[model samples]
Target: MTELSRRELVTFLASLGIALPLGRAAFAQGTGGGGDPAPGAVAADAAAGTLIRFKEPVPYSFERLVEETREAAAKPYDPVDVRFADTLERIDFDQHNRIKYRADETLDLNDGKAPIRFFYLGRYFKLPVGINVVDGDTSRQLIFDPKLFQIPADSPATELPDDIGFAGFRILEPNSERDWIAFLGAAYFRTSGELDQFGLSARALAIDVAMPTPEEFPRFTDFYVGPSAVGGRVKIACRMDSPRIAGVLEMDVKKDGPIVMEIRSRYFAREAIGRVGIAPLTSMFWYSETDRGRRVDWRPEVHDSDGLAVVTETGERLWRPLNNPANVMTSTFGTGSPRGFGLLQRDRNFSNYEDDGVFYEKRASVWIEPKGGWPKGSVQLVEIPTDDEIHDNIVCYFLSEKPVAKGDAIAYDYRLTWAKDQPDRGRVGEVVATRIGRGGIPGQPRPPGVVKFAVDFDGGMVASLPRDAEGVEAVASASRGELGKVDAYSVKVDTAWRVTFDLKATGPEPVELRLYLKRGDETLTETWSYQFLPLAQTG
Candidate 1:
């Protein structure tokens, strides 16, 4: 993605932060996404959250069973045979999100910390993650209760056969009455970004995210949920399966303090897996401060993640601003035993988003701080070109030194911070804003052959320097376009310094853009790398 599209992607993805909480009774009454289950399937006499009696209940040891997942990966991947399409395929968005398990009928065994609320089947979400509860040595099925939910008068959901199950389930607040996390939609899940607002999604694993072949979305085939040790975090074990790989995951989740999840996975590759992305975060970058100039709309910015922040093993911090180009783009920051990397929504100002419906400022900037050292690797970011804002185009993940193939096992441990700002790792200047227009001096006809750009740098070294500080200069280069006179000047009104330059494009093609601030060659600010969009528009 280029600078122009980055601005637009920022504007679009930021708007998707509207996935708010479903109220108590409000959820049960919701008929959105998908409708209710067939009434006939839900026996007329059955009440909500009832004990589901069916196949002989088989009890299993939680710890021993989790380890079994590791053992299961050693064998040839056996495809899961459960199918539930008739009840899922016909459903749409509203019906899918509407499949709210009744709040009153929440599964409460006094075993798991909280009862589970199941999401209904619908269009976007059809396959449900199997839900189960466990105690010291016993496991039980969480019965599906229809009376637990309130249905709309015209709702088309009919309670179906008792044997029918759910897609996946969401874990509500552990200590508080709030809903902090959820396990829904694919092998995807996420906590509210730094601001407690759910935005980007973290998948258990990505088979081939940016590949041409249809991206195969694996499901958490089953969940072994159990109670936490007295006053401790809950332990939910997961078993994942796809045509390509199979593995297990143990999520040790806490509530108020920093929410950290430890993930250990192995791939029993059906064949050579294409691209494996660990701790992959999925988000959208439509347009923002730097790329807004290319937009023809009313909004100022849109995006869930503005840039990709990577910390190398040597402790070097690098920032790569996101983009939405006319074509797919892939960039990698070389590093070793990466300390951390993630898609961040660093810009936190309401003015950035004029749309009152979706508050972008409150969106969380998730920082993936690895708990243990990840072997030599690079933080790879893939940006896919997108015209509209609905599709997520930004993907960030760490590639380990180990090449991915069949029978390969990978264990990754990372701490997911749900706070607002990045941790106090180091001091560095931040890219405040980026803008573009006709390249030339004021009062002069716009330079015929050049595209002008203005980049703002604030905070860190730049903000502390004396007003008349010398040595500070702008370091910039173009991947293809020719660069002209470049100069740096303070904005006067703010602590920001604006770097202006003209790029002479050879033709209609887009160009890769890069810029940064330095003092006597000592780098003081983040290197601002961007993609300059070249769209023909009437002035």
Candidate 2:
């Protein structure tokens, strides 16, 4: 997605009722009072402390949270009250940006090793969510106080009441000005990753995304945060509620090189859902090298991720390049308890992007590694039409084979890795780049209704093959077109191999194309799967 304007961002946040607070301040020397005070200590400070306040202690645990969620699903959905809606509406983008969370009031965790801060409610984020600090078996709800934020004198936020709730919270990089992980707006949360650049975002669950009906965004109404049992990790238990579903998510988040999150979620459906997307990843894909014809910027390429990479349960690897379709398109790949899948930014060269301001090349590639045994499902990819990068038009998620029904209780466990690369790509030739153009040989009259595809593969056994490798061939197939002029050879400068083929479309419908390099009967590279839009292909 391209960079969103402040106004556009506000609108987007307003639609999702989620907003990522802006601004960062230098880390203060002292703790946000004191590190995780003993059980009732924080509650005791409710009457004494002015900067931070907490409600009476309450017994809490992940299991209790799940049970509470199940109970919530059995009842009618209750929406969070928007306190001082008029005042919040007055706090526009400019005024909201001026309102900053007080760094001195940060809640210290792990002896101040990880500083936690709360987000202020604004125009886009009028609804408040419960923020609690967990201490052992007890938790205290953080009381909202106007003093927690440094608001401009002229800001409408000044009109908000002292009991007004928070929009979200973020975990700062220990003693650093920047934050590593942030949870805001619905069930959306993301990390800066190892490169310190935030790109794609992952949602706890997605209902009816890209479906005929409007999508349902489950909001994390409350969060219980504390130190994790695992060393150097923070545990966050969230209570998510929606009109159709109620759920609990327990995340063990740790930042070791690549930010890793062990996520366990349980959902109770209040009503039947047309589609349920688990561990859904949302990103932007406007234009890339392969689809340069749709470029609207001066940069060579613009996208958060380049392709959707999936490893099937049977060990088949597939790479599908992202697209900016003319219309909303959904692709489904039957992946029965797939090993892993993710939207990756494989092209890390800065030269390819030429975008220093946002550093598109440094965007993190988020991967979902399923834990335990997932039921038979398909990895669904939804590509919506987007002219600019500001819009996140790409969504990838796991869709269970069975349809979700009312009273259906489901659970999913997965590990999320936000890093520069996927966790396990396996020992195989991977697709480095995919380019398309007019079909046929250079300097010759190109065939009508035909498109040329050039796929480059690097590493794996393909790298070791000779330039004139005997028996090496490009295996190609198309769903609704004829494939010809297939060729495969090693590049002169490097061990990278290149596969070229031409596809003649017989109809206007999109064609599913697949290609891979093979030496005799042995597969030499990961399968390159693509949706060839005949009508959208530019000559």
Candidate 3:
């Protein structure tokens, strides 16, 4: 992750997390994986030929196709090729996510609406996903048909090949008129953000990620998309392989309010991997809850997620507030086949953010549910302290045995729940606000202290007590400082309580602190954890 625009950063400095523009490789590849729309064959798939016509039963079977491709890719990267029909040849991005396959043209005509639309190929996306519609053995496969799409007469759109196949497809609501999910870009795909507008993305597999060395990103080379009539769901099965890994994917995308995708993937490592990330979510967490008065803009926060929540395999729920560090920060929590983890937006107040456009507070919280029992590993959260929001800053995933190794078979399945509220297992004492300033008391002589902290926590049993309640105690500790007087009492507004404390930072290194309210024998709320960066250099 790199730096972001000063404008976006100033507003989102509290929850800072970032990633650079999808380098060309992160976008897609031409081989067997689901990558961007293959660009070179832009103008034409062939010099000239009869438009591919579907007669009756298409001969292709997605299941058999995947089994064969996986076996072939198991050897080495010889570059699996697709002999595409002319109609499925050259399309662009605008044309990709927008080209709606008409109701009459719906391939699987079993039920309601088969959400079918294609992704066009272009600069950020180049690898073409081999798409073929099946009707038993008589598969009326696809060809890049420019007529199916009506592009706004623009610069990039006008320059594309007339017969380019669609880059990928987004599934529309089977009953409603809107879209529910999409499989586009690189091995990248997503449902809409908090407001039903698409932002940020999730990758099927990540290799050598966040390393100083150049990373390897595998693309989804082909797709076996179908309709699941048995369970009232849409099924999308993907065949994935790269220079480093190979696998299969079966995703059942369903919709309630926010669409949910239950994904199961089988991964095979072709070589030793330094970092293997499972259910990796790439997002921007600029600022939220912590850094406020120092903002460079009017908005209080700008971020896609505000915290990291992990449900260990034993069901112990832990919430770590997201941070915007001055440098790249990576923490690997050593654990077993973790139950689940994800980037989340816990606060859902509009006034807390005060921004009308790009609702930072309303952003969705994505929860990754493990497919099965995973082996011992770590749930890694990489936070790159940055100044802007354009660059993605938050990456949460599972780092497996040595990242990767030759002849390693890694399989995982998880449910992705996209919603506005976080998935907190208990009455966790959630962290509300964290304010930092000079340590001196108001109107008193300023001391030698450089920094002070005021952390506010609400929710749980902490609010039901009286102003003089003594049964509840505030347990506070710091890694490198003398902790000061800690006090707790019920707040006047909303049945919430306020816990205030001060810390005298004693060293140059950051101070790690954890605090929670407990009434003697019982815990009142979820523990609030924080990592405070040391103050700036003074004269």
Candidate 1 wrong stretches, greater than 4 Å:
1-66, 74-76, 80-84, 96-99, 108-115, 134-140, 145-148, 151-159, 174-178, 227-232, 508-510, 535-539
lDDT of 1 by residue, 172-279 (tens): 553333455666655767665435555677777776766787666767878877766645566677778877777676666665555666555544555567787777
Candidate 2 to truth, TM: 0.92
In candidate 3, where is summed lDDT lowest over 10 consecutive residues? 24-33
Candidate 1's TM-score reads 0.82
lDDT of 3 at 37: 31
Per-prediction TM-score to the true structure, in the order listed: 0.82, 0.92, 0.80
Please rank every candidate by TM-score, starting with the best.
2, 1, 3
Instruction: Tell me model 1's lDDT, rounded to 2 decimals.
Output: 0.64
State each model's CA lDDT, in order. 0.64, 0.81, 0.62
Candidate 2: where are CA atoms >4 Å away? 1-50
- In candidate 3, stretches whose alpha carbon ends up further than 4 angstroms from where it belongs are 1-66, 79-110, 132-140, 152-163, 174-177, 193-195, 401-403, 460-469, 506-508, 535-539
Model 2: lDDT equals: 0.81
Residues 56-108 of candidate 2 have per-residue lDDT tens digits of: 99999999999888988999888767778888888766666556666667788
lDDT of 3 by residue, 361-407 (tens): 65678888776677788888888766666666777788775546687
Clashing pairs in 2: 1-284, 1-389, 2-389, 2-390, 18-185
